[model samples]
Target: MWKLNPRALKYLNEVARFGSLRKVAAHLNVDVSAISRQLAQLEEELGTAVGMRSGQGFVLTQVGEELVALFRQQKASEAAALSRIEALQSLKRGRVSIAVGEGFIADLISAPLQAFMARYPGIQISVEMAGANEATRLVKEDRVDLALVYAPSPDAELYSHVVTRQPLELITPPGHPLTRLAPLSIRQISGYPLALIDQQFGMGQLVSLVEELEHIRFEPQLRTNSVAVLKNFVLSGMGVTFMPGLTVHSEIKQGRIACVPVPHPVLAGASAHIVSHKGRELTVSAEALINHLHDGMLFFN
Candidate 1:
């Protein structure tokens, strides 16, 4: 068995994250040459290059990424071990990272997130917004403890803790012409000026699927990757957009946006999934948040 030095692994992981030895060195208050030496020794021991110089920085090779992922797993294990030891103290402290789609951000912040942070003030949580594919990749890579994705595709390496039907709706300006036609077809929606997200997002993926199945394409007045922007576009009366109904509840309540159903099977059956890496043991804090979301969030309800 090959034993990697802990210090060397630390240097490698930091370099990979920062994408530059100099940046890692500056962040760690060490000399760039020192960090370089450690990585060189690591590569020599492994008999292969971990990464190569790219543009202005270094990019990891496949082996390099795997090694960084290994370091992350080891850190997660250590955190879990510490959590067990701290059980008597009632989870006094820990950290959790989660990725989410922009559409789910408001719902997460509205309830479960606020309640959890208030209850567990000592536990730190970091949230990042990512597309469905990127969200799954982050959890699988151990970069995040959990993810909240809309219309997530199946993956063998992930486990879904919560899945709920949160159908995609066509968002329009309040009292807009589209509201007269609830449960509109995709072809009908195309006749109006539209705003849509690109295919990197899960909602966008479902929209693309609908277009393919129905053999019709939509020429949108605007294209973006943000649900917030799409919401604003509708509120500003630029045009209609497509997203989950839960995302625009506040706007609907304020009579700023009108959400109508789209009858495509994919849109009608859209779901929100909270997932984690399969077969990995979560720290006590992460598990608690998962339960909180399952029990408290409107997405799960």
Candidate 2:
């Protein structure tokens, strides 16, 4: 008998990741003693210590490292198998999971993804709103079949199926004094009350990089990870924010918000991407939906 327990493997991976049994227990909403007992049984079965605690945190043994790698591959393969089985339905039935950055949600629901749902009502779709890092992580972990990200960090295990230029712009309430400047400079933007996204998001990261390169900084009145909050900050005439125009396209069209170009070369060249695991084959439904998003969304267009 193989004597392998997927549940034990799952607990081991979480312990390795979090580096503490108590922390993993809290995260998994289980008792710490339960995790310990499971791990003890695992060690008994394998007849080896998989990990050890140190001053820093838990460190996996060489054997444990290899086992984790194998476990990850097994999970990725299982995801692929599910995708293949979903393909057997010919798009009439299947579930497609997508992780999207909060900044892209406005555009995603309005046209691109909604159109896909209409076209294939039989297909089940799950959309998770996450920050840039979380979105990529979800794809990398095979928890999501696809991710829509802006200014994604390069990853060897991730592939970009669609990349479109989505320049970061200065957004303000309609007729705000800054709108007159059209393409504004960072210094000029800083002169106003600034409400910026935190470093967890792509726009915030880009702005921080520019500040570092230019040896300057802005004292933002507010900082957050929520796109809705940023938009509300601008719409309330409280302050200005930096975001892609497409993120607030409907508001701009309604003449409630004004999106002015930011002339910085880095901001001007920013792009959004459709990302997926490198070697995983997407189902027919997943593939078709990606195509729909590319063609139907203003974010891509």
Candidate 3:
């Protein structure tokens, strides 16, 4: 016979992740002795040593790994069950956390988020703006229920849906010289002062790839992580910046900026995707949010 206790499972899981009882206790804001005692009690009940001291810190035994895996599976199953229960009562009560790339956050949430919340007023929603890599990491770590990112790598742990290709564009102040060029090549665009996204943002890899493929290095007038700052620089006629259409769609429509397609080989294949964790069933609220995103993407393009 096996007894399930949430407290025991929580302690074990934290210990497995932190690799030290003291660290886990600190993270949980509990006394180290209490965590040690609880862990010892868990081991006694299970009749096995779950963790062993190593040179660096605690290492989980085989039994511990199996127990942790089972605990995760059970936790996921319980969450799914709760979702079903909530659906029976009403679809209005649930929460979904979404991590989105900064550039697409406005377009991604502008129409769809309002619609979803309007339909289900009781549902709670949280959206965090992050770079593509950080957004993918959040989804993989289950820190967020879903992720919307540009050019994310294929992840085995994620199920991608609602994919869309967004071509890069050269954004400039109105009546800029580059606007005369319908499609500008990388070499041609390099002639002007440029404001580029910094390496800290995930798009730096794309820039690096473009540099390698085109064999050209740009002497940027400015490099920043904020899209707004880049837009301001271009608006002020300081320099031109490259960005996806979604980032500057409104400005282009209002004639505050002009955009020419950047027909670079490296940028032709850039895409945006909505992804969720693989192998785990999504809650009804999460599923509803995904449906809204899918609908939003149709118009986003």
Candidate 4:
């Protein structure tokens, strides 16, 4: 039978988290040699190498990935147990980390994050802004408790909740001729100068798919990975862009931009989702925040 020590598990999981033994050692307030010793012992006992040293740093083996996942489950169980104990004493304390797209911060995440923090001052929260695919990756890697992003293709490792479907919208500077139109089509919009988000992002992928299906190509006047920069391009009257309403709800309300829903058959099918690791029990802090998100997303619509 293989026996695991708590300290060894912590060290291994931290190494996976930071991708550095030195960083893990510093975080755990232990000597660097201690981490190495325990890691060596762990692999020796398990009859497999958890990680191998490389020129750049430590890289987890296939076994190491499985072990790390098990460790995350263990940590989640510990958190759930602690939540039970805390409830008996009327105390709540834990950290909740989220991975979300940058566009979600202003409209979808901000209010709920603030409310959750205010309600549970003892909880610690961290948010990482990333692209939709990056957000999904973060959740899968156990780097974050939850993710808010455009619907990623189904993955068995993830569970999606709090879903919302919104058509992609054509965004333009105030008083652009397209604004006067009731609804817009990809073919119609492609005729104008275009500013496009990069394909690494979900929005970009959606637009690219439509272009390919329609047998048309958009020669963008500006192309960028940054949503803020793309918005700026539109703001400066550089070119029209396509984005979901949730991304630019504030701007539309303030009359700084105009958003007309895309009439493309596929654009109407896009959606947003809140996601977490499948089959993992959430910590009290994470559960609370997810509840807040579910409620607050009503306004995001």
CA lDDT scores, all candidates in order: 0.88, 0.85, 0.79, 0.82
Per-residue alpha-carbon lDDT of candidate 1 for residues 1-301, written as tens digits (9 for 90 to 100): 7899889889888887788988999999999999889889989999999889888698888988888878878887897888877666897888889999988888889878999999999999999989999999889867899999989887898999889999998999988888997567788888888999988899899989988998988898899988888988998898898988889888888888888988878889989998999877788988899899989877886
**Candidate 3 structure quality by residue, lDDT tens digits, 191-227:** 9999888664545557768998878998888988888
Best by lDDT: 1
**Candidate 1 residue spans exceeding 4 A from truth:** 15-29, 47-66
| Model 1 residue 28 distance off true place after TM-score fit, in angstroms | 4.4
Could you tell me every candidate's TM-score relative to the true structure? 0.86, 0.85, 0.85, 0.85
Q: Model 2 reaches what TM-score against the true structure?
A: 0.85
Using TM-score as the measure, which candidate wins? 1
Give the distance in Å from residue 191's predicted Cα in candidate 2 to where it truly belongs: 1.5
Write model 4 residue lDDT over 176-266, tens digit each, in one string.
8887776666667877888988777888888888988999899898889889987888888887898887688788889888888777787
Q: Report the C-alpha displacement of residue 296, candidate 3, in angstroms.
A: 2.7
- In candidate 3, position 263 carries an lDDT of 77
Q: Among all windows of ten consecutive residues in candidate 3, which has the lowest summed lDDT?
A: 292-301
lDDT of 2: 0.85
Candidate 4: list runs displaced more than 4 Å. 14-36, 51-61, 89-92, 180-183, 298-301
Backbone clashes, candidate 1? 0
